[model samples]
Target chain A: MVRWEPGAQERLAAAALELYASRGFEQTTAADVAQSVGLTERTFFRYFADKREVLFAGQDHFQQLFVANVAAAPPEASAMEAVSFALDAAAVFFPDERRPHSRLRQSIIDANPGLHERELLKLARLTEGMAAALRDRGVPEPQATLAAHTGVTVFGVAFRLWVGEHEERPLGAIEADVLRDLQALSPSVR
Target chain B: MVRWEPGAQERLAAAALELYASRGFEQTTAADVAQSVGLTERTFFRYFADKREVLFAGQDHFQQLFVANVAAAPPEASAMEAVSFALDAAAVFFPDERRPHSRLRQSIIDANPGLHERELLKLARLTEGMAAALRDRGVPEPQATLAAHTGVTVFGVAFRLWVGEHEERPLGAIEADVLRDLQALSPSVR
Candidate 1:
């Protein structure tokens, strides 16, 4: 039985993730993802290249979000401040409603070495994008790159906490906690 | 005619890297690598699964070095200090004679997306391994992860500088400079 749904792309993506989680990514096909959503393989192809893309399709947009937010920071902001702003701005990407989905997606990624590598690559790209944005804001070589990397690390740490079982705090709050932990890494920062 | 060599694996790896750099990683083959070194494909197989292993064969040893150094840090050292000690300890992995080879290898990786992803994954694992080491030394969750990530970032930035043209400093000195730059990111740290 097939039924039409609004946001065909979103539905297909969701279905692909679910199928990848249960059946394993290698076992899931494009047609399987589409059929799970009561859609056709043609419709899935229109939205994504394959089942693997269901996890990575948002990477470019996510990188853009980090870059844009960094670029939008106030002129007086330090490189770290710019990254801090970007980190806060990234919370919209994981609203209260999206945590469960994010957790599931993360689990799927963690369970597969190839998918985990893809996840790390995307985060590496995000760090590069943020560094470029910071450089454009007049932050110097190592500082821009360092701050960008730091922010991304915080994001990674906070994201895991956000998706963890007993954690109920928002991503921004967790990021603040992680940022503090980052600052406390040395006696100087303390 | 093949000549007996004292370091056949090293010779074949060197040949593989040269071929990959000149002809592109995708264009190179295991047989080509072996033939370039005056050896047979079967000999190459005994040392490596495929041509790609030429670039990645040291990853486990690399991770082990990091984990070992982190574990050997002074008991009273903070998470960041332990990472700093490990960073300095890693200089042995890149001697003056190896800089040119590393530079060539990095260039090859930068030119290939698959290789670049593998590079990032290796670094990510290094970070995780260091973090786990910190945890074993009694550092807590987010702080251990944060410090581990910051150290790896410094190592990355320092490795780039070490390999860059006109940079005369050793890997240890460049790491110190990058670590200083990382500390100066936030105003409080300054």
Candidate 2:
């Protein structure tokens, strides 16, 4: 029987990020990450489909958190308001203590085209999932799509700022700031 | 001497889209596209790096057009205004007559995971290019990124609506409508 490891995924991910930084992503293997954490290559595979998944595995939790929060929003909340509620939920997924790790992870992703594309693909899926949740709330057509996309975009821009080496603000606060910037850009906002 | 075939690219694309729909994107080959267009396989290679390029070769032109329009917007134009002006320019690339072609192309893309990822990557690059152009106009940080992303999202939502079989509106008009929807979602709009 295989021994179940608690926190195995987080351990493997942190080890993988360290290796991916010291060695290039292409140079690192699942075995390396596994051995770094005193586990076998099979254990790594148990948590992630591949090395790429180590960086992206959080996508599922993020999608679920956003959708759940959107669904849980007040029935009368505006589309953007529902999305804002979701962003606050998403902030818990990236607490203040993880900023350094987030920065490293982002730099690694920015250096690799394949990883970058995977990130964009994940973000697109998140937007679609969030929109579907909003539609379930009866937010119609392009409004659902636009608000979902804007929420994701605001989260993205804010996350980028929050992860900057010199920036110490919390992610949720940055999201609120970016949301206002989005509002200001629209000359016709009510 | 390879005689330059005027409109060879267009002829090949239409033929490829038809074949991709009829025979399926996977079952089709580059040589098949060339033969359907009455050109040599070598000619197809000259025009595209691979069969996939047949669908994406226009991305370069799309990027240039968007960047050019963004740069050309009046100095007083807001970030989204610059992007909206660019969207009008983009509309010319997808006129009323091309709706059927676009719908077919999208169905093909939606059916394939790899092609969909490539499409997302291209949209991401387009957003980055637009943001850079906005930065050149002295736009800063998250606002430029937010506006650029919003513009692309608006274009994407509007394009999907414009290509619907029941929808007969012009692409530019749908774009304007989607933009308004985006503005209205921002409850704090200026």
Interface root-mean-square deviation (Å) of every model: 4.0, 3.6
The parts of candidate 1 lying over 4 Å away from their true place are A1-6, A21-27, A187-190, B1-5, B187-190
Q: What share of the true interface contacts does candidate 1 keep?
A: 0.63
lDDT of 2 by residue, B1-190 (tens): 8889998888888888899989989999989998997998888888888888888877678778978999999999888778878888988988988788788888888888888888888888888898999999999988888888977897789888987879999988888888878777764421
Count clashing residue pairs in model 1. Answer: 0
Per-model DockQ against the true two-chain complex: 0.52, 0.59
C-alpha DockQ for predicted model 2: 0.59
Give the number of the best model, judged by lDDT: 2
Give candidate 1's root-mean-square deviation (CA, Å): 3.3
**How high is the CA lDDT of each candidate model?**
0.84, 0.86
The fraction of reference interface contacts (C-alpha pairs within 8 A across chains A and B) present in each candidate is 0.63, 0.72
Q: Write the per-residue lDDT of candidate 2 for residues A28-146, one digit (tens) a residue.
A: 99999999989999999988999999988776777788789999999998898898888888788899998888899998898898898888888888888989999999999989988
Regions of candidate 2 where Cα sits further than 4 Å from its true position: A187-190, B1-3, B188-190
Assess the local accuracy of residue A130 in candidate 2 as a C-alpha lDDT between 0 and 100. Answer: 87
